[model samples]
Target: MLKLFEIVEDKSPKDRIDELRKDIERYNYYYYTKNESLVSDIEFDKLLKELEELEKKYPEYKIENSPTNYVGATSLKESKFKKVVHKKPMLSLNNSYNITDVIAFTERVEKNIDSVQNELEYVLELKLDGASISVTYENGELLRAVTRGDGVEGEDVTENILAIESIPNFLKEAVSLEVRGEIVLPLSRFKTLNEERLELGEEIFANPRNAASGTLRQIDSEIVKERGLDAYFYFIVDAEQYGFKTHKESLEYLEKIGLKTTGVADLITDMSIMEKRIAFWEAEKENLDYETDGLVIKLNDITLWEEVGYTTKSPRWAIAYKFPAKQVTTELLGITWQVGRTGKVTPVAELKEVELSGSKVKRASLHNMDEIIRKDIRVGDRVFIEKAAEIIPQVVSSVKEVRTGAEKEVVVPTNCPVCNSVLEKEDGLVDLKCVNPSCPAIIQGSIEYFVSRDAMNISGFGSKIVERMLQLHYIKDITDIFELHQHKDELMTLDKMGEKSVEKLLGSIEKSKSRPYSKTLYALGIPFVGKFLGDVLAKKSKSIDVLASMSKEELLEIDGVGEKVAESVYNYFRDEKSLEIIQKLKSFGVNFGKVAEDKKDEVKVEGKFTGKTFLFTGKLQKFKREEIKDLIESLGGTNLSSVSKKLDYLIVGEDAGSKLKKAEELGTVKILTEDEFLELTKE
Candidate 1:
C-alpha cells in the first residue's frame, strides 16, 4: 500500500508520478464505475491536485489516458448495456471555491472573445450535485440516454431513464437534439431509501448523489422507478445548430419542448449582481429539496463559446463556483457509547469543537465498530468530519498523516456502558445491543420516545422533564407517565414547577389518555413497528386483547406486516413485562381498542371523499395530524404514506417541504388547503 504521507525524497519524479496515477485511477474506478466513494471529496481533490502538479512539473511523465485528462472512469467491461459514443464529448466544468477565480475566468473569457462586438452577459444556474447524463431525442421521440462515462463513451441507460417521471419520452415539437442534464435523487426519497436499506441490513448509500448514480445503473428498472429519481435538463449539446443564440434561450426552449429544467436561472451583465446572487444562494440553497454544491456561471452568448473554446477536460467558457467545503479536519478526543430505546448501543466520537456548514459540531457518529476499524480512526488522531445532508455530523475518515505515537486504538465494549450488562450482537446485524431491558438508558430512551409527538403527543413532556422525573423517582416507565397526577404536590415543590405549571403538566398527561388507539400502540415502543404499521395493526386486530392473542402466522397474514415485523410484534405481546405494562396502561383509562361503529365519530365507507387518496405534509395549525387522518378516514378517503403519481390530493400546511414540490412536479395531484379540503368534504 502506498502511504499518502510517505517520504518521497528517495523516489524519482517518474516513480512518484506513477504512484499518484495508480492511486487516482483506483479512486476513479471506485467512485465512477462502482458508485462507491473510497475517500472524501476533499481528499480526492488533494490527490488529483498533486497529480496535476506533478504532470505539469514533469510533462514527460504525462500520458493521454491519465486520470487528470479524462472526465470520468471508463464504462465497466462487464456492463450489461451496450456502449454508445457521444456526438460531442461531455466535458466537465472548471471549479472555483473563491470569488477571485470567477473574476479571473471572466477576464480570460473577455480577453479571448471580441468584446467590441458583443456585450458580455453571464447566466447562472444551480450546480446540482448528482450524476451527469446525456439523452438524445430524435424527431420528438426519446432515443437513448447514456451516462458520462470517460467523456467520450458511456453505457446505455434508456430503460432506467424511462422510469424517471420528470424526463419526457416525447418532445412537444419534432426535433432531433442531444441534451445534457443531471440525474438526482431528491432528498426525501434518499432518506426513505436509506431507512429501508437500514431496516433490511443492507449497506446504505453515503449520499444522494451516490444513491442516484447507483439507481441509474441498476439493471432492474423497477428499482429505478420505485426510488423516484428526478432529472433537470440544462444544456443542448450543440445549441448553435438548433438556432439558439444564448444559453438562457436554449434552456427556455428545452422547457418549451416538455423537458424539465431547474427553472432557476439569472442572466446578468453586472458582476456585482452575480456576486450578490451567489451569496444569496449560499444560504438559500439549504431550503431546496435537491442538493446543490455550487452555482454554474456560464457565458450567456452561445456564439462566443466557439471563441473561448475548451480545455482538455473542462470548458473554459464556464466555471463552477463551489461552496465552502463541508468537510473539516478536527481532533478525535474520545469515543462514547450511547444506548437507544431499543437497547442498541452506538459509538459516537467526541471531537474538538469545529464549525461545519454554518453550525458548531462537537460530536459525530462513528456508526459502528466495523466502521471504526475500516476507517482506522483512533483517539488523539486528526479526522475529517462532515455534516451529512447538512445535518447529523459524521466522521468521514482519519487523517493518518497527523497521527502521533500517543494515539490509542478504540476498543469495542463487551458490556453495556450504563447498566454494566453483557452486550450481544445478533446475526446478520452490525449493531451491538444490551439485552437488559431494565438499563436506565434504555428505560429513559423508551419513555422519551413514548411521549414523542408522533407517538402519544404528550405536550410539554420533553426529554429533560422525563430525565428529571426519573432522577427524582417520580417516574420509571411509560405507565408512570399516566400516573404523574398523583405526584402533583411533589412536582410543584421542584424548581421551575409552580402550581400552575404542575397543573398544566397533569392536564397534558390526562389528555394523552384519549389519543387514538394507533398512537397508543406506537407509544409502546415495539421494534420494527412505526406509525404506519401501528395504524395497520390497530385497524386489523381492533383491540389489544385480540392483538396479544394472535400468533406470528396470523400477524403475518395482515397487509404491510412483514416477517420481521410480525415476529417482533408477536414476541412483544407474549413478553410478560410488556403485558404487565399494557395491563397497567389499560387500568389508567387509556384507549386500547377502536371506537364503536355506532359512535358519532365513526369512519364511513362511502362518503364524498370515497376513492380519493390524501397526504399531508408540514406543520398543521387547525388540526392535529391524527385528527386530520381520522377526519379523512371518516369521510371515506385513504391516507398515503408518501407522494406519488397515483395520489389524488395533497393537503399542504405551512412550511410544506419536499413532498409539496414533488406533488407539483407530478401535475396529477390536486393541492388543497385545510379550508378547501373541508369544503370538498361538505360537497
Candidate 2:
C-alpha cells in the first residue's frame, strides 16, 4: 500500500510524480480491472492529488499514461466483445477544483476567443460519475454501444447497452449519427444492489461508479437489465454534420430524437451568476438520484468549439469545475447517540467544524454501531466524511494512518442515551433499539414525524413547539395534538406562544383533522410504512378499525405491499397501545377514513378547462397550488409540473421560473395571466 507521508523529500518533483503515476496506474488497474482495491479511496486520492499538482509544476514530464489523462477508467474491456472506433473521438474535460481555478479557466476562454466574459454564453452540465459510452443510430435503428476507451476505440457492448431502460432502441428522427452519454447507477438502486449482495453473500461494490462500470462489462445482458443501468446523452459526433450549431441545440436535438438528456442546461454570461449556480448545485446535488461529481462548463457556441478545437485529448471549449470532493478529512471531537421515532439508536459525529461543498458542517451520521466498528472510527481520530446526498453528512472512513495514541475507541452504549433503558437488538438486525415505548426521545420524535409535511402537515407546529409542549406537560401522545385547543391559555404562558401564534397553531391542528386518512396512517409512524404504503393501505382498508384488523395475507393482496410492510402494519395496528391511541383520535373527530372533499363535482358540465392540459408555476395569489390542481382535476382538466410541446395552456402566476420560458420557447402553448385564468373559470 502507498502512503502520502512516505514520499521522499530528496527526490525531485518529477521523479516523485513518475513514481506516484506508476503506483496509481497499478492501483487503478487492480481496483477497476480486478475489482480488488489495495488502498482506501482517500489514500488513492492523495496520490492522484499529488501527481496532478506535480504535473502542473513539471508539465513536460507528464507522460501519455498519466492517470489524470482519463475521465473515468483508463482501461476496461471484455475481449469477447468486438471493438469499434468512435465517429469523432470522445473527449474528456480539464478539471477545475476551486473558484480561482474556474476564474483562470474563464480568463483563458476570454483570451482565446478575444471575447469579453459577458459576451460568452456558457452552459453548465452535471458531470455524471460513471462509465462513458458512445452509441450510434442509423436511420432510427441501434448500431453499437462503444465504451470511451482511451478516448479513441472502445469495446462494443450494444447487446448489454440495449437493455438499459432509458436508452432508445430506435431514434425518433431516423438520423444516422452517434450520441455520447454517461451510464450511471442511481444511488437508490445502488443501495438496493448492495443489500441484495449482502443477502446473497457476495462481494459488495465499493461505490456506484464501480457498480455501473462493472455492470456494463458483464457477459450476460440479463444481469445488466436486472441492475437497471440508465444513461444521459451529452454530445453528438460531428454535430455540425447533423445541422446543430450550438451545444444547447445539440442537447435539444438529442431529446427530440427520443433520447433522454439530463434536465435543461443553464446558460449564463455573468461569472457571478455562473459561480452562484455552481454553488447552488453543489448544495443540491445530493437531491439527485444519480451521482454527479461536478458541473461541466462549455462554451454554448459551436463556432467557438471549432476554433477551440481538440488538444489530442479534451475539447478546449469545455472544462469541468469539480465540486469539493465529497470526501474530506476532519477531526472527530466525540460521538452522540440519538433515538429516533422507531427507537433506533444512531451515532452522530461531533466534528471539528469543516466546510463541505459550500456550508460549514460540524456533524455527520455514524448510522449504527456496526458502521463504527466497520470504519474503526474513534473520538480524536482524523476521519473522512462526506454528504451522502449533498444533504446527509456521512462518515466515509477513518484516518487510521494519522491516528495518535491519544485517540480512544468509541464505546457502543448498551442502554438508550436519552433515557436509561436497556436496548434490544432484534435477531439479524444491526440496530440496537430502545424498546421502551414510553421513552421521551421516541415520543418526541414520533410527534415530530406526525406533524411533518408528508405526514399530517400541521403548520406552525415545529420541533421547538413540540419540545416546549413536552416540557410543559401539555401533551403526552399523538392523540393529544387534536385536543390542544383546551390548552390555549396554558400554551400562551410559554415563550413565543402569544395569542396570534397560539390561534394559528391550534387552527393548523384543527385543519390537520381534515387531511386524508392516508396521511394519518403515515403520521402514526407504523414501522416500515411510508406515505406511499399508507396510500396503498388506505386503498385496501377503508377505516382505521378495518386497518387494525387487517391480516398479513390480506395486506399482501394490495399491489406493492410486500411481506415486510404487511407484517409491520399488521403488528402495529393490533398492538393495544396503538389501538387505544386510534380510539382516542376517532373520539376526537379525526378522519377515520378518507376525508370527504368539500367541493361537489359538476357532473356532465362543459367548459374551456375540460380536456385541456394546464401547467402552473410560481405563487398563486387566489388559490393554493394543491387547491388549483384539485379544481383543475374536478373540471376535467389535467395539471402538469413541466412544459412540453403537447401542453395547451400555462397559467402564469407571480415569480414564474424556467418552465414559463420553456413554454414560450415551444411557442405553441397559450400563456394565461391569473386574471385571465380567473375570468375563464368564472361561472
Candidate 3:
C-alpha cells in the first residue's frame, strides 16, 4: 500500500529498482494466480517505468527474470491443464485510446520501416473482446489448443477446443503449423444461453466475453458444445514457415485452408483510409456478432513486421487502437429534473451537444442532491460526462477552471417536477418522492409496469403506446386498460393505429386479463416486490383476498421476505387504491388468484445441506459450476464468493488456484469433487 514517492524517498537506485520488481511480482501473482488485482494497470505501469529507468541507468541491476522480462504471470501451477510452450510468443499489442498515441504509433512504424506513411500496407482487424488461444495443427489434423496464460507457457484445453463447431478438426491442406486466434461467444448465442439458464432457474452470465471464457474453462465438453462457442484465427504464429509474405496473405491462407478468420479484416495502404475504416467499425460495433473493444492494426508485410521487432510485452509492428472511453467533456447548459414511477426525482444535466462513445449526447443524470453537492456541479460549468457501460449517461466531474460567477447553483426541488405535488421522504429512505398516489409519473410508471413482458405481457404495447395512451387520456389508472376496448374508434383514429392495429391492441389487452396470479402481483409495482418474490407470495397466498388479509408478522414468516418487503406488501394491500384495483381486476376476470405450478418447495430444506456453505474453485467435470451452485442453494446452502477459513466446503475442479491452497491451510473446510459432493447430497 506504500506510495511510489514514499518508497523511493531515501532508497538507493538499485534498492528502488529491487523494491519495484518485488512489488510488481507480488501484484502480478495476485492478478494471475489469485484472480484478484490490488493495483490498477496505470499504477503498475508507473512502477514498471521507474524500474526500467533505474535498470537503464545502472546496467548492473538489470537482473534477468525481472518483472520487466515477463509479459504476465501464468495460471498453470497445481492445476489439471497441460502446459504448452508457444511456438512463437503470442505477444500483446500496445493500446491507444486516443488519436495522438495512434499517430505516434504510425510515426514509430514509418521510422522503423524507413518508408513514407502511405507507402506501407497495414492490416487492420477488429479486436475481439474474448480470451486469446493458440491452436497447433499436425499435418492438417487437430493437435492441441492452448490459452494465452502468460505469452510464454499456456494451459492446454484441447478437449474444450474440440467442442467448437466453427474450428475444423483438419485443414484442407496438410500442414503442421501453429495458429493464434480469439475464442468468442456470439452475442445472439450468449443471449439465448442466458435465456435458457433463466428458464432453468439458473444464474445468467454477465456478458458474451465472460461466457466464452467460462465455457472454454468448463471441464465438461458437452456443456461447451451445447453453448456454441466460436474461434477466429488472426495470425499464423510463425508466418514465414507457411510461405506467407504479408499478414493479409496469412489470413487469406487460413480462410483457404478452412480455418476461420474475422470477416472484418481489411488491408489498407493509406493511413487516412485506415483511420476512416476504424471510425466506421467503431460506430457500427454494436452490430457485430461478437464483442470488440477496439481494432488491432499490424504491418501487412511480414518482412517489415520482423524488422520492426518487439518490446518486452508488445510487438512493435502492431498496436491496438482502443475505442475512446464513453466519457466526453462538454459545457453544462442547464439542469432538469425527471420524476420516475417510484416518485424519485433525479437531476439531469443538459449539456451542449457533444459526441460521446458513438452517439451525440445532450443530457446526463446527476443522480441526486448528494451527488450534485459533492461535485459542486452548476449550470454553465464545463463538465465531464461518461456513459456508464456505454449506456446510461452520467456526469463524472465538473471542470472548476471554467466555472464563472455567472454559473447558477443547482437546487433540489421540494415538489414533484411533473405534478407539482409536495415531495416527502420515508424515515430510512434517501430519495424524496411525491406521496400522491395519482402523481402523473407514478401513474405512467405503474401503467408501463403492468404491461411489461414479465407482468401482463401485452404484445405490441411499448413506451410509445403508453405515452400515446396517456396523451389521449384513454386510461388514467392502470385498471382503465380493461376499458380500452370501448375506445376502439378513438384508438383507430390515432396515428399508426388503424382498425387492424386497434384490434390487435385490444386483443392483447383482453388476453392480459388471464395473466397468472404471480405476474399480477409483480405488475402492482410494490416496493421491494420482484417477480420471484411475487411468485413466492402467490404460491403462499393462492388468493388476493388472503394476501390482503395477512398481517406484517404473517408476511415476514415467509422465507426471503425481509421486514421492508413484508411491510411494503402489507401496506400496499391495506391501501384503498390497491383494494380498488384488486376489486376491478377481479371484476374483469384477471387471474389474480391462480398460482402457476412450480417446484417452489425444493429450494427450502433443513436436512443434509442445511446451513452448509460451498465454494467452487477451478473447474468441474460432471456438471457446470452454475448448476452445482444452484443445487447447493436449493438445499439450504450458501455459495461462498471467496475462499476463507469460514468456508464449510471447497469444491475443487480442474486447474484449481490459490483457493485450494487456502482451503488446505484452513484444514477444517471439507474439499469435495463434483461426484463426491453429489454423493453427500444423496444422504
Candidate 4:
C-alpha cells in the first residue's frame, strides 16, 4: 500500500494537509513505479481532490513538490517561450536482432564492469513508434512543447500538444521543469481513425506510426486535439524544479504530475541481464498496445549516465534492442492447388509483393478447403503470411476490406493435378486426398516419403534427386527404389549425376530395405499411423504380421493408439495391394520384428526427438554435424527443416549459415556445442 499520509491520524487540519502531500506522492509511486494498485484509480483521484481542497484551505501547506502543482492555469500569451538547455542529452537505444544479441550486450557490459553495490537490473520500455518531443512548464502554467527534430532545435508544438487531454494545463504547485516523452495514439484509437478514413474514401495511413506522425504535424492545433492524442512523459530534462538525483526518481516525480509512463522499466547494473529483458521484449512486441520496435535500455545511476554520456548520434549509457520479423502482410493475388506427398490436393495462395521477416514471399500454403472457408480469405484481399516457426510460408489472416472486388472465389479441385486421380475429401478430416496409391503422383510422393525422417532416415536423398528420378520415370514405387541399382548407368546420364552420387544414392536405397518393420509401416503412408503409433505396435507385437492381425479393440489396448488410428492401421493392412507391397519389402530384406531378437537392446534413441523442433546455426568446433543432430534426437527434439521462432534452439557451428544470424535477430536461444548443450540438461 502507498503511504498516503506520513502524519499521525490525530493531526490537526493544517498538519493533515502536510500528510496529504506524502499520501499523493506515494500513490503516484505505486501506480507508476510499481505497476501496483493500493486503491482504485477513482479512489486515488478522490484523494488527490481532497489534497487539492486541503491545500486551498491552507495554502501554507502547499509544498513545491506537491502533486497538485504538476498542472496549473495556462497563461494566454503568444509571447515567444524561453529556450531551455537539457542537462543531459537523451540517447536512443541500440536495436536488437534476437535475444542472443540482448544477452550478448549484457555479457559485454558485465565483462567490462569491475564491480557493483546493488543488484544489476535493467528496465524494459516499449520503444514507441510515434513523435518524440520535450514539454516545459513554468510557474505552474503551460509553456511550450518542442519536437525532437535532429535531437536539438525543434519546431514549437506547444499549441498542438495542449490539445491532448493527458497533458496538464496547470501545475498543482508552482513547479517548473521540462519533461521528454513520445506522443502516440492508442492502437485501438488508431485503428478506429484509419477505419473512418477508409470509410470516408480518404487516403489511409500505412500504419499507426505514420498516422501519429501526420496528426502531430498538422498545422491546426485543434485538429490534433480532435484526434484524441495522448503523451506519456518518461524523462526529466530539468532537475532544479524537482529534487531528483536519478532517472528513476525523475520518473516517479513525473508520475506525481499525472503523466503516463511505461510500467515495465527496471534499474540494472549488469548489461547482460538487461540484454535478457530486452530480448524478451522482442518476442513481446505484438502483445503491446503501442508499437515497440526495440527495447530502450538505460544506465540506472544518473551519475554514471553523465560520466558515460553522449557520442555523436547516441548516448553510450543507453541502447535499443530490436528483433527481426519473420511474418509480414501482403495482398492475396489468388489461390492455387498442389498435390502433397499423400496425393492430398492442398490449396496455396499467391501473394502480391510482400517481404516477410527477410524473405520475399510470393506463395504460401492455405492448408486446405476448410482453412479457406474458415479464414474467409478471398483473392485480392490483403493477408498476413508467415514463414511459420516451421517450414513453408502459410497464410495466417486476410484484410477483408482490402479486397478490390476483382478477386474470385477459389473452387476446391475435384481431381489431382498430377495424375487426374479422383480427389477424395476424408469424412473426418479436412484434407482432400487421392487415395489411389498406384497414381504416378502417389509414386513420386512415396519416394519423397521413403527418404523422409519418419521412414528410411536417409541422410542424402533430398527433393531435387527425387524430382529428377520421378520425371525420368527411373523409379516408380518403393520396389523400384530397390531396382535403382540396375539403373545407375542411366542415372549417370542425367544432369548433376555422377558415378559417386549415383553409387551413394543406390547404396542408401539398398540400406533402406533393411530398415525395421515400424519404419516400413510408417513409410507405407498409412493414414493416422505416425511415428509414435508405429513404435507402439512395433514394440507390442513380435512381427508386422502379428500387429496386422490384431483386432481394432486389441489395437486400441496398446498405449497411445487411438480407435481412429487403429482403424486406419487395420484397414491399410487388410488391403490386398498393401499386403503385396509389404511382402515385396520383406523379400527385399526389410527387417520384420523377430521374436527371438534382444528387444531390450533396440536402437536406444527411438522416437526421442521425433516431434520436437530444433534449428542449427553458427559454428561449433566440438562436435560433427551428425553427432550434434543425433544428440538432439536422443533428447526427443525434432529437427526443423529451417530455423523459426518455434524452434527450441539454433545449434551454432563455425561458419554458420544465415539462419544463425536470423535466429539471433529473432531473439531465439541458440545452443553453442555438444558440451554446452549437455550442460543445459544438467540444469
Candidate 5:
C-alpha cells in the first residue's frame, strides 16, 4: 500500500480539479463584468486549459455550466422546433441616415397619435449588431434556446444552450418566461482573437458578428464551448404573466434575473423627450465596447402595447431607430498629399473603387500624420472610412483582419504632392504644414476656398473647373477668378462644357468679383478663419484693406475671434505672398467691404431652471424633455451634467430617475416632474 501522505496526495488530484473549476468561473465573471483581470491572459488560459484537460480526462468532472463552454455546443443538425407564433411580431426597425430622418420619425409618431391629450413616450434600447437568439424557461428551468428563424419555428439548440454560463440553468425565482437576446463578441475581443489567429497561421474572421455566427454554428459542441461569447437579454415574451405593468418593468425584471440588459434603455413618456434620448444614444453609441447599430423604441405602458399590438410582421407599439453605419472599407491603392485651406498638409488615400454609405468613394482624407499612425493605416490596407458624420471624408480604421500581405504601409510625404514644398510637422499639433503660402498646393486650395460658400459664394466655379484652369495655366490664385474671362475658349473645350455653360460660369465669376470685403476676406482662405469667426471679423472691419492692417490686439476685440484666429489673420497679412495675392485680387475687381447686416440680440433673464440637471426616468405625462432642453438652452442655461449633488434640482418626470433614489440617498435636491419645473420657472 502507498504511504498515507502519498496516498492522500494521489487522491488530491480530484480536489485540485474542483478548485480550478471554481477559480475559472470566478475569474470569468470578474473579467467580463468588471473588466478587471486578476491574472494575465496566458495565466488564465493555462488554468483553463488545465481544467479542460482534466474534464476531458475524467468526463464526470465536467460541470454542466463551465467557462470552457462559452462558445456553446454545435447547434442541432436539422432539429425540429414547434412553431411559436410570436404574441408580438418581431418587427424590423426603421433606420435613419441622419438627424433629419430621426426628426421625421418623431413627427410621424406624434402625427399618428393625439399630440396633446396623450403623451406618446418611447422606450429606447440599443440595437445590437449580433445574432439574435430566443430562450425559453419553463417554471424557472432552462428549456430551450433558438435562433429567431423567420420569427416563427426555429432550430432547437437546448444542448448547446446549456453551455452558456450567463444563461441561468435554473432561475432564482421560479416563473415561466421566455426572453430574447443577442449573442455578440466585444470589439477588443474580436481584434484580439483575430490577432491570435494571425500568429497561429489561421484565416482571420472579418468581424465580431461573423465570428460569433461561425462559432455558434460550429458542428462540434466542444469547439463551440471554447471560444468566449456573451449575450445581452433585452425583452421578456409574455411579460404580462410576470406581472409587469410596463416594458420598462419587464426589462428591470430581466436584469434582476442576471441577464445583461442594455444600459441606455429608458422609459420615455414624452414624445419629444423620447426623440432626444434616441438622438443622445445615437451619438453615445460610438463610445461603447459592443456596437449598437440603432435604438429599439417601444411603447411603455403594457396596456397601450396590447391595444396597439401586432401587425402582420411588426409590433405597432415599437419601432427601431437605426443609426447609419459611418465606417466602411475600401482598398487604399496609394497615398497623395493635398494642402488644405489652412496651408496644412493632408494625406489623401487613393482607393480601389468601393462604395461606402451609399456613395461611390474613390478617395478619402487621412486628416493628418497622427491619424495615419494611430490607425496604423497603410497604402494597400483595406481601410474603413466615414465622412465623419457627413462633415469631411476621413479614414477611420484599417481592417487588419482582412489585410493581404501584398498591402503596403503608407509613408508620409516629405513634400507637398502639388507644389513639392517641404512639409513640417509643428509641435503640439498633429497636422503637417506647408510653410510656403505661395506653394502651388496652397494657391489651388485658397482658390477653391475663395469660391466656397463662406467666401465669394461663387455659384459656378467648382473643383473640377478650377483643376482644369490650373492645368490650362489660365489661372494661378484667387485673383484668377476675375481673369477667367480671358480663357473662355479654352474652358469651352473642357469636358461637359459648351458656350451656354461657359457663359453661365463666366457670369457667376464676374458677379463674384465685386463681392463684399468680408466675402473677399473669407475668399482669402486665411488659416483659422472659419465661417463663424470670419463673419465676426468681416462685421468688425470697415474694409478688407483695414482688416488686413489691423494688429492682433485689435482683432481680439471682436467676439468669437480668439487669439489663434487673430494670429492666422496677422500671419496672412504679413506674408509677402499673401500681400501680392491681395494686390492682384484688388486689381481684378475683387470687392473689399462689408456684405451682410448683423442681427440684433434679444436678451432676457435666464430661467430659474438654468444650469439645473433634470434626469427623466420611467414614463412622463406631458411634454418631451427634448423640447424642454431646447427651451432651457434657449433661455441661456445649460442642461445639467448628469444627476449629481451639484444639480440644482432633479426634475422628476414620470417613471423618473432610477438614479433619483440614489440621488435621494446622496441628499441631492429632487423636484417631482416637469409640472413642478414649469411652476418653479414661472416664479
Candidate 6:
C-alpha cells in the first residue's frame, strides 16, 4: 500500500531495484521492530520476489545487506534489552502458497541428495501465526530468550518469556540446548484484550499475532503477564548434538523435557497423504484456540538436512505452505456514516465485491474519521481489506501505488446523517457522537434494545414491528411499550394484526414488566452498562430510584463500576428526558424494583444448576443463546464470558470452535450437548 516510488514505463531496472530494497527494508522495520504490519504478507512477498528477480538479472545492482538476503530487520539501536548473538543463525523457511511448490521442494531435496533406497519421510506441523523467538537452556534451567532479529542477532526477552506459564522455567533433563518456537496469544485471550482496550478508547490490535508481538516487546513484564501469552517449541538449534536422528525425534525430546510442542503433527511417507493432510488442516485450523496461517513441511530425516543445506535467508530442507490470501484490493466506492444506539458515529466503506477467505465481502468498516485520514483512503481509490481474526472485515490500507487524479478525499460530516443534528466530539476520544436525544435513529435503537431478549424478554417486538409502530406515531419512547394496550383496537386494524395477534402482543408487553431489576437496568440502554455491569449495579443499588439518587462518588464506591460507567449512569438519571420517560413508565405500571425483590424470593437457589458456572458456544437449535442464558440464571447458574478453570459446564452446539477445544484441554469442564443441557434443566 505504501510505495517507495511511482511506477513509470521509462523507469530503469537499477532504479526500481533500489526502490524495492528501500520499501522492503521499511516494511521489515515496521513488522519486526515495531510489531506493526503496514502491508499484507502477499504484498510484502510480491515486492521481495520482484526485487529478487531484478537482483538476479543485474548482478551490478545486488547488495550484501538487501532484505532478500536477511531473515528480518536488525534490532532497534535504542532497544531496551541487551543484544544476544544466536549460537546458530535462525534462518527462515521458504514460503510456498500452493501445493505444487511444496511438492517441488521435496523433489529438489531428493535431487540434491544421493539416490534414496526408500521413500522419504516428511513431517507436517501447523505454521503458527505469531512472533518468532529462540530460548536457550543451561543445565535444564532457562538461561535466556531472544527474538528473531536479523537472524544473526536478537534482543533479550527473558523477562517477558518467564511470564508465560506454558513455557517451563526448568526443563525435565539437564542437557544444554537452544530451541526455537513461536510466541502467540490465544484467540480467546486476544478477543478479551481487545475488548478491554476498546472500552478504554485505546487502539485495538489488528490480530492475535500483533497482540502477542507487542506484548512480548513491552518494557514492563507485568503487562506481558496480564495478556496471557503462550509458546510452542518446534525446532532444536542443533539436533545432532542432542543425539536426535530425525526431526520427529527432536520434537519428542522437546516434549519429554517438559516443553510444549504443537501437539498436532503427522509423519507421512507419501506426498499425496501430505497434500490430503494439508487440505484437512485448512478447514480444521479454524477450530483451534491459536491462529495458524498454514502448515510447515519439513524433511523427517535430520541427517539429510545438512546435505540439503541453507540458502542465504531460508533453509532448503523445509518450506512453509501458506494458505490462500485473506486480504484483497478493491475499489472504494463510498463511505456511509452509521449511528449506533450509543450515538457513536462510524464510517462504513462500500467496496466492489471481492471474494476473500471463501466469502464475498462488499463492505468493510473504516472505524472512524481518524482512520480514514491516517490511511489516506479516498473514494474511487483502490483499498486493501482483510477479515480481522477471520470474523470482522475491515479496511487495512489504501493502495496509493495506483491512485488516480479522479480520487476524492473522504470528508467528515459535521451533523448526524439521519437526524440532521450537530455532532459532538469528546476530548481524548476519536469518535464523534450525536448528542441529540430526540434523534429518530437514537430513539428507534433505544426502543429496540429495551424489548430485546436479554433486556425485557418482550416477544412480538422485532425491529420491523418497532419501526412500523414508530411510523404510525403509536410509540415515541420505551414507555409507549407499556401503554400499547390503550391502542389495541387501533393496532388490530393494521396489516397482519388481527385480534388474537394483537392480544398476544399486549400480553408479551405485560409479561416483560416482571423481568428482574438487572434486566431492567440493562434495557435502559445506558452506555457501557452491559449485562454483567447491569447485574452488579442492580445487586449493589437494590432499586432504580436509589441508584438515581446516589452521587457520582457513591456510584464509584459500588464494585465493578468504573469511573466512565459511573459518570454515564450518574448523568443519565439527571437528564430531564430520561426522568420524564421513567415517570411515564411508572404511570403505566412497569416494574422498576418491587417485582425484582419478590422474584428473588422465588428463585430456584437449590436447583440442579445451583453453584455452577456455564458457557455456551457456537449455534444452538432449540433455544436462542440469550434465552438459554436467562434460563440458566433463573435456575441459579452463572453464565461466564469465556472459558476458564472456574467454568463447570460448556454447552456446545453445531460448529463449536476454540471455546470447545479450550474447555476440553482444561479437562475440568463438563461438555454437554443441547439435548443433554435440556435434560438437566428438567425438574
What does candidate 4's lDDT look like per residue over 1-683, in tens digits? 23443446677877676666656656555443333335434345667788889888877656433566432111111223333433333444555556566666655554434344455455556677678878888987778887775343455767778889988888666777778899888787878877986785444555666556656656556767877787787777634224454677777777776767876677666656655666577677778777665567665555334224343345555667655445678888787777766777788887887765434678899988988989888888888887653236899888876677777777778887777877887778888988777777667677777777557855345555666667778777776677777887887776555666567667777777677877777777788776645655775665777777777876764545667788898898899988997788778788777633443323223444534556554444566445666576566454554445667676664545445555767786565565666675454
lDDT of 3 by residue, 123-237 (tens): 8899998889999899999999999865666888999899999999999989988888999999899889889878854447767876777677665688779889989989887
Could you give candidate 5's per-residue lDDT for residues 1-683 as a string of tens digits?
10111233455556767777667656554443333334433345567787778878887656434456553222121223344544333445544555466556655654433222455556778888887888888888987777765454354656655666667788777877789898887878777887887885444666677667656655456655666777889888756544567788888888777677866678666656766776788788778888677777777766444334343345556666767556777778888777775678778888787765445788888877778888898777887778654435677888899877887766767876667777888888888888886786666776777776446766445565566677788887777778778888987786556677678768878888777665667667777775445655665565676677678875764445667878988888998977998788777777776322431111122566544445444444555545665666565444543345655566654443334565676685665666876776677
What TM-score goes with each of the models? 0.45, 0.45, 0.46, 0.41, 0.41, 0.43
lDDT of each: 0.81, 0.77, 0.77, 0.65, 0.65, 0.80
Q: By how many angstroms RMSD does model 4 differ from the true structure?
A: 29.4
In angstroms, how far off is 627's CA in candidate 3?
A: 12
Higher-scoring candidate on TM-score, 2 or 5: 2
How well does candidate 2 match the true structure, expressed as C-alpha RMSD? 24.6
Q: Once model 1 is optimally superposed onto the true structure by TM-score, how far is the C-alpha of residue 575 displaced, in angstroms?
A: 1.6
Candidate 4, residue 650: how far the Cα is off, in Å: 43
Q: Candidate 4 — which residues are off by over 4 angstroms?
A: 1-327, 358-360, 387-392, 595-683
Better of 4 and 6 by TM-score: 6
lDDT of 1 by residue, 144-180 (tens): 9999876666889999999999999999999998999
Instruction: Give the runs in model 3 whose Cα sits over 4 Å from its true position.
Output: 1-326, 516-518, 531-561, 593-683
Identify the superior model by lDDT, candidate 3 or candidate 4. 3
**For model 3, what is the error of residue 393's alpha carbon versus the real structure, in angstroms, after optimal superposition?**
1.2
Better of 2 and 6 by TM-score: 2
Candidate 3 local distance difference test against the native: 0.77
Residue pairs clashing, model 1: none
RMSD (CA, Å), each prediction: 24.9, 24.6, 25.7, 29.4, 24.2, 25.5
